[model samples]
Target: MNAEGLRERWATLTRCVCDGARLMVGQGNYDTYVAHIRKTHPDQQPMTPTEFFRERQNARFGVGGRGGFRCC
Candidate 1:
């Protein structure tokens, strides 16, 4: 591959690795979240990165008494 193409591939691979690590640690991928929201929920506003992080933490730990047993 050309230099630019190799650089792009390396960047993509690095991003995927970082995203996976974040997921393993219970941190959501903000960019992916925004992309999905724009594609699937175009009329709704996407959350700021801080809001998204808080939401993910709440969902993972069931905080704020919003609901119990989210999986159910």
Candidate 2:
């Protein structure tokens, strides 16, 4: 019921997503998860596999290509 508890619960539910596994719906509950994503990212278009992978990499660790880390 606390912040940590809530985060842990979310992490548990999203373990497969965190691990970069393609999403799989189970027990007809896929809509719930997709809805969660839509709610979180209301304005963003869904990314393709290449875009998603690139963005995911840049978000956490920052990627090399695509004008990353410009130094003047």
Candidate topping TM-score: 1
- Tens-place lDDT digits, model 1, residues 1-72: 899999999999999999999988678899999999999999999999999998988877668886633665
Ten consecutive residues with minimal summed lDDT in candidate 2?
22-31
Misplaced by over 4 Å in model 2 are: 1-35, 64-72
- Candidate 2 structure quality by residue, lDDT tens digits, 24-50: 211223345457668998876655546
Query: Total clashes, candidate 1?
Result: 0
* Residue 48 accuracy (lDDT) in model 2: 54
* TM-score result, candidate 2: 0.30
Question: What are the per-model C-alpha RMSD values against the true structure?
Answer: 4.0, 10.8
Best by lDDT: 1
True lDDT of residue 52, candidate 1 = 96
In the predicted model 2, the residue pairs found to clash are none
Error of 2 at 61 (Å): 2.6
